[model samples]
Target: MVDQSHSFYLTSSLQQKLSKLVLAAFCLFTLYFWPQRFELWLIQVVIAVAICSYFSYTIYRLKSYKSSFTLHSRNLFKFANNPNEFECKVLWVSPLLCAFYVLPNTEVEDQAGKSQLIIVWRDMLSDSNFRHLSRLLLYIRRNQASG
Candidate 1:
């Protein structure tokens, strides 16, 4: 029988997305103005600093995540080097390309502070596994709303 529960490892999609976003920001910023606009150099520098900050955050998240997440019938659990399993709630669900975005339940309005997980469908062992995970998440979400 197919297991209702499964573990998902962090994928490289996160890194790729962050890098692409950084590149896009630089491209957009440069394209917004002409090369002769020397007075607006300050704006370019400010945006560059913002991009650098995002790059640093990306690196930190990638380095700190040394674990996988186990999704069960009722709750999602994270296993890392810390030993103690961390429980998480589904803050949001969306299919981005072939992957799913998940956020831990938090009261904070900003999603950046919440732990996020991206599960890539193509990275799964089989199609059935991916389907099962999807159903499980849907079930849990429904249960949360009813109870």
Candidate 2:
């Protein structure tokens, strides 16, 4: 692959859909376990209101989130909202997720003690970019493990 930076908008469409589906399933599960007879109608109303509130708030939060990322080779990445592009070390990688340990400052740390692990989700980028990133991350994962 060329040593070019890939700018990605973190819309995460697929992940959002999957999460919504899972949450909807959980709501259904809650309904299944809910009382059969409305003997205590007040308790039923409370349960219903609580579940709906949780579901709505979660959906709102998901929809409101917006971010952009730029990956500049295996060792460097930056958030678009941030001004500086910082050096980060790759921690681990899988098909669906990759973790990067970002140094606290712009440079690499001695012990990496202040490194923060940030997750890059699969759906954060386009299909081609995500695949390219996955390959790069896998390579980094291999090198990190042995070093």
Model 2: ten consecutive residues of lowest lDDT: 104-113
- How displaced is residue 121 in candidate 2, in Å? 5.4
Candidate 2 lDDT tens digits, 50-112: 877777777777766677777765556677876655666777677776777766553544534
Candidate whose TM-score is highest: 2
Give the total clashing residue pairs for model 2: 0
Clashing pairs for model 2 are none
Q: Which stretches of candidate 2 lie over 4 Å from their true place?
A: 1-4, 27-48, 60-65, 84-124
User: lDDT for each of the candidates?
Assistant: 0.56, 0.68
TM-score of 2: 0.58
Candidate 1 Cα deviation (angstroms), residue 15:
9.3
Error of 2 at 137 (Å): 1.5
Clashing pairs in 1: none
lDDT value, candidate 1, whole model: 0.56
